[model samples]
Every structure is written in structure tokens, then in C-alpha cells.
Target chain A: MNDNPFSLWVYLSQSPLLWLTVTLVTYAATDAVSLKTRRHPLANPVLHSLWIIGLFLLLTNTSYTTYFAGAQFVHFLLGPATVALAVPLYENRTRVAAAVLPMLVALAVGSLTAIVSVVLLARAFGLPREIILSLAPKSVTAGVAMGVSESLHADPSLTAVSVILTGIMGAIIVTPLMNFAGITDFRGRGFAAGIAAHGIGTARAFQVDEVAGVFAGIAMSLNALVTSLLVPLAVTYLLR
Target chain B: MLEQIARVLLWLSLGEIAAKSGLWPLPAPVTGLILLYAELAIRGRLPDDLGILADRLLQFLGMLFVPAGVGVIAYLDVFKTEATPILAAVIGGTAITLFVTMVVVNRLGRTIAISREPGSERVEGAARDVNA
Candidate 1:
């Protein structure tokens, strides 16, 4: 199998564009399906695209490094995309200003809960110290979470995986869970999603409503800042 | 469009420089967002060109995360070994955070709403137009 010179898989795997195109096309198709299904939580395009891409890599025996070579182009946009969150935040400035106090309080408590719960639970399960440290910033965006993990001498790749799973879990269940809890306020819903899930959750909030999206953006940014500062200190103090 | 993107990239670069300089313990993108927000605040509105580009990028923001999210494949071994703790922490922790944050924010929002009026009603109407 490794010596198959004529194999299409080998050729495609060699091409950097393969993973890039696969990512974009799979996301577009999954997004369409999500729309057709009226954006049902289970029809989440990110989840679908992730599974599809993961399976593609597995079936082809393509290394993640190879896939990421092309996919980095898309990954590069995350920085700018995160900065672009300011547009919505600025657009909703008045509401943000009015709710600043509550947002700050929520950010404080939410950030704490996200960090503490993961650490406590991970410890209770007797996970390794590095794993617990990686889980500390799981609710932050991948880039920031990775940075935090690295600074804590934890595994960045593990942190990235934890962050994605945290986001997916929050995106899939937060809204319904909030609704059951009688929380219909877009601001609250969006804030909670951002605090719990970070970027993916903020994206999900955007899909639900603009106001929610705006607050989600704000929460995501604030959570990143708060988590980066607090996670290291908390890990040293509590875990040690 | 090119110019607008360049301007946004400039801000992002500035943010990266600032973060790298170690002046603030924040992510470059976040610092960039804060800089952008400050610019908007001082300018009173987003420049038409930049707003268009930013809106376009943000409209499909989820797509930007697909690449990184797919990195999960790299950690399949970790997942296989630590699946229970990882899943328990992520799922249970996120649920708890979501529930607690929503409850706290909802309560606080109600307190503010008593005096502020339901701004979301008007915002929802405007949001419909933009979303449409």
C-alpha cells in the first residue's frame, strides 16, 4: 500500500491544495445541509465538516501535518476573523455600554466556573497534571488556549483538541439548555455560549441572532483575556 | 475590497506587534479587536469599506475554525486513553458554565431591564433587517 506509485490518494495527499479544498468544500456542503435543515443543532456544519475531514484523513492515512500544510491558509484567517468581531461589537456598542456592569460580572464568574469546573472534574477523574493544565483554558479560543497551555508547560495540541470539544459541546447544547432554564435573553444566551465555548460558540450565537452574536464576541474576547491571566495562576495555586 | 482588507490586516499586525512586545498579556487578535473597537469609538462609525470587508469575513466566521478544529485528528491517541476524563470535563464543565452564566446574566439582565427597557426588542427588529 505504501509503495503504490499510481495511487490517486498518494498524489492528492502530496498536493497541498487537497486539504484546503476539502475543508472549504466540505464546510460549504455541510453549511448548506445545516441551512436546509433550518440550522438544527445536530446539523451543525462545523461538527459535520470536522467528522468528514477527520474520516477523510483516516481513510487516506494522511498525516495531520500534511492536511494542515494547505489548511493553514484557512487557519491563518482566524486571527483576522477574530479581529473582525469588533465590527459587531462596535455596532452594538450602546447595548454593550448599558450592560457593561453585568457583562463584567458575568465574565468574571463565567471564566472562573469554566476553569474551576474542568480542573476539579479532571482531578476527580485522576487525569494527569498536564492534562488538567491543558483543560484550564479549554473554553478560550484555540490559539489563545494553545498559548496558555504552552505557557503552563502543558501540551498545546491537547489544549487545541480540548478547546474544540468544549466549543462543540457548548454550541450543541447551550441554547437548548438555556431555553430549558428559562433563559431567552439573547445577550445572556450569547454571553454564556462565548464563555463556555469561545469562538465556535460565538459563531453559533451569530447564527441565532445578531445581538447574541455581538455579545458572544464580546464575551469571547473578554474570556480570552481573563483566562490567559487567570488559568496559570489558578493552576499553580489550586492544582499545586 | 483589497484596500479594506489591507487596513484590517494592518490593525491585526499592529495587534500582533503589541502582543509580541509583551505590553499586554492578551492574544494578538483580541488586542486587534480592542484596537478596532477603539478606532470605531473615536471615529464614530466604521469606515464603509472596512465595515463591508469585516462583515463579509464575520458572516462566515465558523469556516475559519474548521482547519484548527480538524486538528483533533492529531490527538486521537490522547482521546483514546483519556476519553473519559476529557469528555467528562469538557461536556460537564461546559454545561455547568453555560447554565451558570446564563442564569447569572439573565438575572442581572432582568435587574437592568427594569430600568433600561427591553433593548433587544428594537435590536431584534434591526437584526432581522441585517440578517435578511
Candidate 2:
């Protein structure tokens, strides 16, 4: 029973509790920062949380594998959260039914454009096949994007990061970009944000306007479906 | 709460079985999403507990990605080597997707005159009433 500070840390870090507590605590702090700024898109809690945790690991010489041993609890929720999207979709069924035509068009065009543009740009810039494959699903929600990456045999971790980055970019730029384009339709605006950025963009839409948020929710779910299917087909064709 | 958790897990389990069996090309969670949605559509009303459960979990949805996103640290070398291309693809591709999708959809809405058409009410004011 040689109980010293270093021995305690070695013991604590080996257990899942330490990293799990760190993950949650870091998120709560970063989330407060995001809230403090009135939910500013640039102040994304996930982005802040990741870098903070990442840096902590770097300084401490902790491997991601060890950190993930505890943080997987949070990651596991992504599956149930994906399923939970049904609640919003069910609640707004009437609105979805009304604008079926435009939603359908947006889904098709937006989903294709997201996949194609990423692949082509990545390829043109001479990114390797694996990176391009991972980038293929960057526009989808993180969970679904990771699944797509796994199916394509690309790096799911890389895909997850790309998806987050894309979401942050979409959330930050959606309002200003839409305003500059002189588009006032919340439906189209929300749909574009959801399709282009996924859940983070939808969160931004919810902050700005309820109607936009609902439409963004709808678009996010629908685009998740469309992008998952399209990514496989598009990758095979484009990369072949 | 226990019942709601069980319900979600039940659907998720079935989704996993389906995915593992290669019966669906979609991810397990996605298949679960569809199954849950179809069940709700058939039932024609959201279960109170289920809705509550969803809201509770989804409120902090952003936090869930932290674990995976931190995996980026392991790939610092990848980012350093290909930062330019990767950033260009993500930022540029997103902008183009947003611009193209919004412009096209907005133009379609205007040309269709969805707002003026009676009983449609797909525009701003009517959207509130529907949600309300």
C-alpha cells in the first residue's frame, strides 16, 4: 500500500472514472463559455471541449485510447441521440408534408453537392484516397458520418473531426451567407444549414428562429438519411 | 424513465442485429431512427415519456462529440501535412453547398408562390401557426 500522489494518479488514470470525469467537466466549462457569448457559433462547445481535452492529453502524455476508455460513455449516447431525432421529425410532420417538394429537391441537390464537392476538391488538392474517403461524409451528422466512414474503410476518427469542423463552419456562416444572398425564407435557410453543416448548424438555426430551427431539424434528419446512402455510391463512382 | 430507456435500447438492439446481419446498408443507429420514426407514425402520437427522454438527451447533443473529436489529436501529423487541402475542402465545400442549396430552394419557393397559394402556408407566418 504505497500511497503517494504519483501512485494515486497512476491508479486514477488507469480507471475509466478519471478520464470520464475530465470529459464531462471540460464540456461543462466550455459549454458555459458558449452560453456566455449568447451561443455564438464560433464559441462552439464541442470545438472548445475537444481542443481543451486534446491539449490536456498532449501535456500529460496521455494516449487517446486511454482517454477514450472513459469518454466512450458520452460517445455511446450519439446512437440513442440519433434515434431521438425521430421525436422532432414526428412533431413537425405537418410542416414537412406541406413543403415536401422543396424539401425533396433540397435533399437531393444538397446531399449530392456536399459529397461531390468534398471529394473533387480533396482529390484536386492531391489528398490521398483514404482522406478523400473520410471527407466524403463530412456533411453528415457525426454518428452517421462515422458509420459511413467505417463502411468505406476510411478512418472514422478523421471523418468525425471533419464532420465537426464542417458543422462549425456551417453554423458560423449560415446567417451571414444567407443574408448576403438576400434569402429571407427561413425554410430554405434552415434546410441549407442542416444539409450543409448537420446538427451544429441546426443548433444555430434553433437559436436564431424557431421556424428555422424546426426546418433545420427536419433537413438534418432527412439529409442524414440521404447522405448515408449517397456517400457509398458517390465514393465508388468518383474514386473509381 | 426506465421504460423509455428500454424502448430506445430495444430499437437500437434490433438495429444492431440488422446491421450485423448485413440486411441493411445503413448504420445501426440510423436504422433505429427509422424504426422509431415509423413506429411513431403508426401510433400517430408521440409518447410523453419518449419525447421527454429525447429532449433530455438531445439538449446536450454537442457534448457527445467531444470524445470522438478529441481523436483528432492522434492525427495531428495528418492535419499538419494536409492542413491546406483538408481545410479548403471542408470550408469551401460547405460554403458552396450552403450557397447553392439556399439559392436554388429560395428561387423554387418564389417561382412556386407557395406563400400566396391558399391552404399551403409554407412561408414564415404560417410556419409559426403550424408549429404553435
Candidate 3:
């Protein structure tokens, strides 16, 4: 069996099924820990999944391309999942509409704050222009953030990485931060998460409360639009 | 279930076309979200299956980004070269953004409530009761 051409390791390595299974299993395992811990912020499944899978790949010497070949199926679902945001939005359309004024005010101020703060902080820390450009859209979802990064002539992959890091950070901290601040409003909490952390933050909000999840979904979508426009302008005016 | 999946895919496809048209800079998924929302609004009701589907899939929304996130390993060099500024900007900037946005929105919530009808006080009460 060790010398056989059709050995299990050889076959598994060649097919997309292996990495796909690994991705699902890793997420399920980490998520179980998250649940058992009563959904503690420190038990963030995404953060856990990243390191676990990342280490597994490093150990096996598997290239990311090979891994993504199997994992793309899960990644593709992000599109449909995004579309499905409409359901929660529609379900709470009355509340969303009722809070439109605050949402609008929060959206503009929050969106600008997200961009300006990142750029200024990065510049203050002496990051290069290209890196600063990439960091500008780090708060938006990966897809939109990558697009904005490319448009700004920065590294899209770096933007994707920062976007995920931002998401993980946002997911982990939002709960304790909000609770400590005595924020009892799900709408505000979720909206802030969506703006600062994107989908992962929205996921965290959903785990906490349905109302927060819905509002987070709205904020994530809206911020994608607002951030795309603001990033370029901020890049220009601030960079100059 | 199949119908719900098709409904989502249909909107997503339309969103792709809209995005490719370059009339808007929005991502296809964001466009898809808007299109689906408009559809639900026009229909004036959500399909039960779709709601169930959204809830199920979205519950694992964090998982979906793991693959691309793992791709970050390839660019670990960037982080290694500029760990301080990068970490500071991503961590510090996100924290500030979250704190500012949350505080501002929460404070504005009161002003917004006062601006509404007398009956709208219940909205404020409901928000307070949500995680209280």
C-alpha cells in the first residue's frame, strides 16, 4: 500500500474534495468550541479556523492555490449569501426605515471615519503610500475592498488580508467593547460592527441578536458603497 | 429549497451583469443584495424557504471567508516587513472606528427618537429591551 500509485494520500492530494472537507471540518470543529464556550469573543471561529487551517497547510507544504481549488466552493457561496442579506433587511424593513435617519447619519460619519482613521494612522506610523492605499478600504467586505484597493493602485491581496484581519479583530472585540460601553441597542451595535468589520462582524452580531444581525447586514452593504467612494477621495486629499 | 437557491442565484446573476456594465462601481454581491431587497419590497412578503435559507447560510457567514483569508499566508512577507505600522493601523484604526461609530450612533439614537412621532417612543424602548 505504501508503494501503490493510488495511495490514499496521493489521491486525496490531487482532488478538490480533500481541502474542501478540511475546510468544513475545521470550521465545524472551531464553531463547536465557540458554541460550548457560550460564544465567547475570544473563541472566534474565523480566527481559529484561519490559524488551524493555515498551520495545516504549512505543515503539509500545500500551496494556497491547491487548497483554494477545493475551498472555492465555500468561497463562491459568499455571493449568494450576500444576496440573501435582503431577507433580513426585508423582514425588518419597518424598523430599518424607522431608523433611516440615524442610519444615514451614522453611515456617513462612520464610513468617513473608517477611511480617514486608517489612512491617518497608517501614515502616522510611516507606512508606504501603496500600503496606506490598501489599508484605506480594509473595513469593507473582501470583494469590495479588493476592488477599491485595485482602483487606488494598491495591492488587492494585501487589502484582502487586512480586510480579514480587520474582520477578525472587529468580531472579537465588538461584543466586550459594546457591552462595556453600556450599549444596549442592537441596531447601533450591529451597525457599528458592519461598518468597522464587514461580514465577519455581521456574523458575530447575528450570533448575539437577530435585530443586530439585520442591522449589521444593512450597514455592511451600505458601507461598501460609501467606503468605495470615500477611499479614493481620502487617498487623494490626504495623500496630497 | 431549490427555488430559494434559484431566486438568490438569479438576483446574483443580474447583479453580475449590472456590475460588469460599469454603470456602478458596486460589487456584484452588493448589487445582488439591493436587487433582492427591491424584489422582496415589491412582493411585500418574504418566502419562508428563503428566510430559512438566509438564516442558515448567514449563520456561517464567517466560515465562507476562511479560504480567501488563509490566502493571506502567501503575503505574510508584507506583514513581516512592516508589522508595526500595519498592525497599528489595522488594530488601532478599526478600534477607533468602532468606538466612534458606536458612540455617535447611540447618542444620535436619542435625538432621532425625539424627532419622531410620540408613538415612536416605543421604538426606543424596544431597542433598549433588545440586549438589556
Candidate 4:
């Protein structure tokens, strides 16, 4: 056991894989805990999962890079995971065709809100051009967010955190908040989460109802398209 | 799991190609997705086995972020460098996006009632029917 790269002794000695192993295990377990706790919106699979993993990393004194090597395998899958979303959308094409107009309108509104409000407030607060660039695509998924960040000359890492935070927050608050606003329809609840939260919100929508999940998926994919175009263009032409 | 592994690798290669092409304005993964979707549309299914393959992948999608999440180390100091403004943008930006989505989507919901489709609102009623 002491010879294993991630064993307790090797871990204490700062094995590279130790931190990543612990991070993965912790999130996997925490996800279970959050799901078991009655599907609370606050459960936030990403938040709770990361919190659990971060604490473990801190306790072990293992650096983030050490863990990322092993975890990159999982990270690498995000692209394919996104591609897989096509299956469900295929299954729900009928619903998607029906709601295309409302979905498109919702996406345009959400993407604009993300860009305008962030830029206005960031400028009002006197943020640097770089931070403002990163903020431009914070509402989109990580894949698109990172792409927007790079094209606009912002820190992709910074964009990643903002995107993840938006996703987790959107996942937790969207449903009840939407119902409160009198949106009891699948298109509304799902699209809000999808356009706003991206993949994480889509996952949250899955637990609600199939209709919500379908629209959420479409909303997510379409928002990824629209936001990707809008964010980079804004930074290039408008913000500059 | 085996099929998923191969499929993912294929998708990654496809994504990389799209990203580097510079032919269109679209991002790589999205371009790959478009290609994949076109294939699916023409074929009328994403290779039957992909259904089960995708289900298993989605179940653990959260775990996949571990790599990117840990990369937060890369930015720990960016916080100190531009602490005040960065915090404002993240917190302020998130709040506005959330608020705007709620307002726009719900309003759009009333206009389109996008849930007019059968699948979205089928859960509760469907459950009761199953039980009965």
C-alpha cells in the first residue's frame, strides 16, 4: 500500500495522483449525499462536490496540479459528453420544434442580459479590461466560456470559475424561482436553467421532468452557440 | 464503458479538428456537434448503441469537472491582483444573469407556453397514471 502512488503514506509524502484521486472520490460521494437529501435545490452537485473535494485536498496538503493529471481524463470527456446530448434532443425533436421560437427568444434575452449587465456593472465598478472580457461569457458552458475567454484575451481560468458558479447557482434556484414567477411550463423552467446554467442546470432539469430536461438541453446547446458568437464579438467590437 | 471510451476519444479528435479549422466562426466542439448531428439526422439515429452509452456518461458528468475545478489553483493570485473588480464582476454578473433569465424565460413561457409539448409537463400526471 505504501508503494502505491495514492496510498496514505505516498499521499502524505505528496504523491501527485493523491490529490486528484481524493478530489474525484469526494465529489462522487458528495453527489450521492446531496441527491439523498431530498433533492434540495441548494444541494448543488458541483458546489457540494467541489467543497467536499477541496476540503480533502486542503487536509492532505496536496496541490491542485498534482490532482489534475488524473482528473484530466474526466475533464477531457466534457466535449464528448456534450456531443452525447444530441441523443436526448433527438428523442425530443417534436417538443423542440414546437418551442423553437420561444427558446430562441429566451436565449437571446439571457445572453444579452449576461453581457450587458456584467459589462455595465463591471465598468461602473471600474474593473480591468481583462476581467471584463472574462465576464462576457460567464453564462455559457465551460467549453464555450473558455473559448470566448481566449478569443477576447481574458483568463480562461477566471472564466471557468465564473461559468461554474453560474451553473451551480442556476441549478439550485431556477425551478422554485421560476414557479414563483408563474412559469409552470416545461419550456420556461427548462430553458431558464439551460440558457442560464448550461450543462449543470440541464442535469438538474433531468431530475424534474423529461420535458424540462429536453428543453433545458436544447436551451443549453443553443445558448452555447449564441453566447459563443455574441461574447467574442462584443469584446472585439463593442467593449474594445 | 468501453464504447463510451472509444466514442469520447473520437469526439475529442473531432472537436480538435473543428476548433483548428478556422474555416467557420463556430467553436470546435460545437462544430463537431453539428457534424455529429448532421450524421444523426441523415442516419435517423446516433448508432443505436449510443443511447445506453450516453446514459452511463451523463450519470457521472459531474465527476468530470474535477480536473478543471482543481485548476482553480492557477487563479488564486488573480484574485489578489485585481481583487476588488474581479469579485464585483463575478458576483454582480452572476446575479444579473440569473435575474434576467428568470424574467425573460418566464415571460417567454407565457407567450409561447413552450410546455405545450407533451413531454415537459408529463411527470406528475404520468406518475399518477402509472400508479393508478
Candidate 5:
């Protein structure tokens, strides 16, 4: 009953290759929509891309496992991508050193602030401990966030949400807050976004200026380094 | 192309070893990065093709985050279980972290001479006094 070619794309619907295709096309469409219009903050490429991908998976009854296979192309690049960003960080070394300690301090304090606020709030609201723990340390990059969540015995999904929301919030607010604080330097603003927002924030920073993108990339690398270390310790020592 | 591939592979292996070694606190990726830099130092220059590969990779880096972003959908149970706390953690934590980071970095910028805010007369005045 099933035609080989016709059913192929349909059966492949659940294949990672198919899902990855859907994922990329979904993002491209959303990005086009955002660009054609006013580049609305909420219409963020990551956020909208996720939405379309999610809907496709839901409609097609495909699991994330099927998607990850194809999507690994993107994942595989993440390491190289981080190293590549180093080029810019090196180019901007003078500026990077200017606030190295500050960035470290921000990451530490930021990690703590992120974890504590969630746990305490969850406690206040009488939420389950697993969920609270999951929410902790979610402000970091997804890899770190997922790692932290797994280590903490929290749901990776919850932590993932916390991380993305934290990033989107940071991308949206960092500029205005910097304006208010009278700190409008592209490097400073970009760095702040990168540290707080992680990958998504890095993307948003690029939109503001090339300098922002450059510094944000630097900040992101540094933030990933710090949170990967600190989030675990915080859970083992303090949160537990 | 082969040389570029070899170097990239070299960098990846070095990073993996670093992560497995448990020496510095950085992740395998960071360790990988440090190794890449060291390789560059020894080689004295990264070839153009390698740069091109890296550049193309970086362009789609943002989209790479989407799969992880989908993790949010899976964590829907997390929302219900730790609703208030999760919100507080993300919102409060972000604002505070951004604030404190900016303060420390700004102050540090003043101390160092790489001021991000180049036109600020106050910071300029302070730097001049220090230089004088």
C-alpha cells in the first residue's frame, strides 16, 4: 500500500535526518518571519524555531531521539564552534582581560543567584524538591544546564526551560539595563548578555552590534567554563 | 583540506584528553580550546580553510541551541512542580547576576585601561591622573 518514494519521506518523518531537516526549515521560516517584520524580541529565532520543531514532533508522533540523530550534525559542530569563537576572543583579548575577574565573579554570583532564587522560590511555593533542584543552575548553556540538572536529579526539561527563559530575559533586558546604568560600551553590554544569556543571548548580542557579538561570544565561552564547574559544586555542597 | 582536518582532529583529541585527565577545572571543550590555541602557537598560524570551516560553523551556532531548547517542552512537568521557584530563579537570578557583573566589570575596566565606555569624561579624567 505504501509507495517507496512517497512513504519514504513519510516514514523518514521520524528519522533524525528528516527531523533535522524539519528543524532547520522551521528555523529558517521563523527567522524569515522575524526579519521581514520588525525583528521582534519575542519572535527570537531560537524561541520560534523551537516552537515549530516542537509542533512538528508532536504532530508527527516523533520522539526527540529520532530528531537528535540528524540534529547531531549541529551538536557535533558545537565543540568546533566554541574553539572557532576563540579567534574573536583572542582578537579582543585586551578587552577580555580588562574584566576577567569581574566576569568570573559575575558567573559565580550569577550561578548562585540563579540556583538559590529558584530553590527558595519553589520552597516558598511548596513545589517539589526535584523540580526546584532542576530549576537551579539553569542560567548556564544547555550542555551545562542539562549536565547540572542530571547531576542534581532534577528534570533536564525544567532546567532547559529555566536556561532558555533566563537567556531570552537577559537578551531583552541587558541593553536597557546597561543604558540605565550608563554602561553602553559594546563590549560590556555584549559580555553581560553572553554571560547571562548563554547561546541565545550571544545571538541577540550580535544583533546589537558586531562588537556585541564578538564580546558575547567571549563571554559565553567563559560563562560555560565557570558554570560547568560551579553549578555542580553548588548542588553538592549548598543546595543538597 | 587534509591538514585542516588533521589539525581539527588534533584539537578534538587534545580536548578529550584534557577532560579525561581531571587537571584544570575547564570542560573538555575548554581544554580542547586551550589545546587548539597551543597548536596554533606551535604551528604559528591557522590555515585559511580551517578558519573558513570555523566561520561557517559559527554562523549556525545559534540554531544549534534549538534541540536543547526543546528540552523545555520535555520538562513541562518541571513547570508545574516548581512553578514559582523556577520563575523566581530565572528572573531574579538573571537581573541580579547581570547587575553585579556589570558593576564589577565596569569598576575593573576603570582600574585596567581598557575602559568600554571610552567617552566618559570621569573615567578619562581618572585614567589621565593615573597615567600622570
Candidate 6:
């Protein structure tokens, strides 16, 4: 009769299921709290879950590689989720079409501003060139941002980290910041979040409102396309 | 539910094909989204099952990013080294971009609303009659 707590932990750590279960359970618990709190910025499920899971790993002395081995399943779902964004865009087609020109102009300006500002700021901060280049596509989705970083000879891992941070920060601050600025239009809110934060921001937008979600999805995808094309050009001519 | 998932996967597969073939520089999911939207636009209506499935998936969209977000733990060393500058650039840059984008889009949206008000009012009135 081995009643040792550490024995159970050892057994669980060897199995891939532990991380999978941990990730889902942690997220579910935090998500419930988020909903109960009306999705307060401080109660953000992603941030909360990340902290919880990271702490768990640290406590267990589990390496990220091993944890990701099982947790990758949840990460894999991001692709299908991104595809599902089309449903809302289609559902709101009429409204989207009505604001097409404004969305386009905003997209162009927003994407350029995100890239230029990050690059300049990183340079001004005396960061390395690779870091600056990595920060250039910080507002795009992780996949696209990593690609842009690789092309620019920057660290993809750093880009991924920056991209996630940008999303989380944008999600947390965009609403309150916009409220402070007296901006209340769902489209404007969504567009700003999507263009500045990418997928994470889009996720936050969806949490706020369906209309905001749809526009955020649109802005997320559009920023991905625009940033990928523009960053390389900017890196070559502007950064050089 | 299975059928709806299959349909969604089918669109996602097409997107992957476009991405792998270099026909689209955008990610597979983004292309998938565009493909799905195009199909729905052509069909002129969303099937109920797919609609339900999409809603369910989108509802938990934030959860999907948690795994990657947790990767922050691995980079704690990087943060420890250059935390100040990185935080400053990321936070400051994002705030600026958010502010500028919101203002531009909000102004643009207002302009569009005013310019199209007359035509849109008629369209809305006709839509109301249809609903009635």
C-alpha cells in the first residue's frame, strides 16, 4: 500500500496524459472563473492558465519540451479554430462589405504602424538587430510571425514569444484603453485588437462581442498577409 | 457533428494545400477561412449544423493559445536578460498601434456612416418591411 504523494506524482509525470489533462483542466478551471467574472482583463483565462500551468511545471521540475509533448494537442487546435473564424465573417458578410474600404485603409495603416513602431522602438532601446527584426512582425499570428522572422534571419522562438506577449498585452489593455479614449464602435475595437494583437487579440475580441470578434478575425488574417509581405521589404530597405 | 467537422476539415485541407503549394503565402488556416467564406458566399446561406459547430469552436478560441502562451516559461532566461527593453518595446509599441488604429478606424467608420446614411436608411427600411 504505497500511499506516498510523491509516488503518484512520479507515476503521472512519466505519462503523456498528465500534461494533457493538466493543460485542459487548468484552462477549464480558469475559464470558468473568467466567465463568472464577466471576462475581466485580470481574470483572463489564457493568462491565468499560462501562469498556472507554468507554475505547475516549475513545481514539478518538468521541462517545457516534455510538457509540450502532450500539450501540443491543444496547440494544434489553433489551426482549425483559425479556420472556423470564416463562419462569423460569412455570417456578418453584409456589414463587412459595407465597411470594406475603411477596413482596408485601416488594415494598411495599422499593419505598417505596428511593424515600423516596433522596429524603431527596439532600435531606440539599443536592442540587437536580430531582436528588432524579430519584433517587426510581433503583431501577426505565431506561425506567420515565425516565418517572417526566419526570412529576416531573426530568432523564430523570440518572435513567437513576442507575438504571444503582444497578443496577451493587447487583449488585456485594448478594451480599457479604448474606453478611456472614448472609442466604442465594435468594428473599431475589433480592428485595433486584431491588427495590434493578432490571434490572441482576435480571441479577446470574440470574448467581448460577436461583431467585434468577426472584425477582429478579419483584421487578424489581413494583418498576417500584410505583415508578411511588408516586413521583409521594410527590413531590407528601412532597417538596413 | 461529424459531418460538420468533416466539412470544416475539408476547407482546412484545401487551405493547407494552398499553403504548401506556395499558391498562398498566408497560413493554412487563414486560407482555409477565405475558402470557407467564399463557399458560403456562393451558397448564399449557412447550414445550421456547420453554424453550430463553428460557434462552439469559436467560443473557446482563447483556450487554443494557452499551450503556446505557456511557452513563456521556457524563455524566462531571455526575459531576465533583456526584460526591460523587451517589455518597454512590446507594451509601448502595442499601445501606440492600438491607439492609432482605433482612432483611424473610428474616424473612417464615422465618415462612412455619414456618407452612406441616406442610402443605408432606405435599405434598412426595406429590410424592416421584409421582416414585418
TM-scores for all candidates: the values are: 0.93, 0.86, 0.94, 0.84, 0.81, 0.93
**Model 6 accuracy (lDDT, Cα):** 0.85
Of 1 and 5, the candidate ranking higher by lDDT:
1
Looking at model 5 chain B, report the run of 10 residues with the lowest lDDT sum: B123-132
**TM-score of chain A, every prediction, order shown:** 0.93, 0.84, 0.97, 0.86, 0.81, 0.95
Q: Which regions in candidate 6 have their CA more than 4 angstroms from the true location?
A: A1-7, B114-132
**Winning candidate number (DockQ):** 3
DockQ of prediction 6:
0.44
Per-residue accuracy of model 2 over A1-240 as CA lDDT, tens digit each: 565888888888888999999999998898788777767667777778878898999988899899999999988998887788778778867666667787788789999999999999999999999999999999988878988899999998789779988987898888778867767777788889989998888767765665577678777877888898899999999999
Is 5 or 6 the stronger prediction by TM-score? 6
The alpha-carbon lDDT assigned to residue B130 of candidate 5 equals 23
Model 1 iRMS = 2.5
Best by lDDT: 3
lDDT: worst 10-residue window of model 2 chain A: A203-212
Note the DockQ of each predicted structure.
0.59, 0.49, 0.62, 0.43, 0.34, 0.44
lDDT of 4 by residue, B1-132 (tens): 577457655765776776687666666556555666666788886666777776766666666665675566445565676766766666566656666776776666556754474454554344333211
Q: What is the lDDT of residue A33 in candidate 4?
A: 75
The docking category that best describes candidate 6 is acceptable
Q: Which ten residues in a row have the lowest lDDT in candidate 6 chain A?
A: A179-188
Stretch of 10 with least lDDT, candidate 3 chain B: B123-132
TM-score of chain B of each: 0.83, 0.79, 0.84, 0.71, 0.71, 0.83
Alpha carbon deviation, residue B75, candidate 1 (Å): 1.4
Please give the C-alpha DockQ score of model 4.
0.43
Tens digits of lDDT, candidate 1, A84-183: 8888888877788888888999999999999999999999999989889988999999888898899889998888888999988888997678657766
Q: On residues B1-132, what C-alpha lDDT tens digit does candidate 2 reach at each position?
A: 788889888898899999899867667877788899899999898889998998777777777777877886577576677888899999999999999889878877666646645534445554343221
Please write out the lDDT profile of model 4 over residues A37-106, one tens digit for every residue.
Answer: 7566777567776766666667867567666755666787777877777767777777677767766777
State the number of backbone clashes in model 5: 2
Candidate 6's residue-wise lDDT over B9-119, tens digit each? Answer: 888898899889986777899888888888888999999988998898888888889888888767867757887898899999999999999999889988885365444
Judged by DockQ cut-offs, the docking class of candidate 4 is acceptable
Docking class of 3: medium
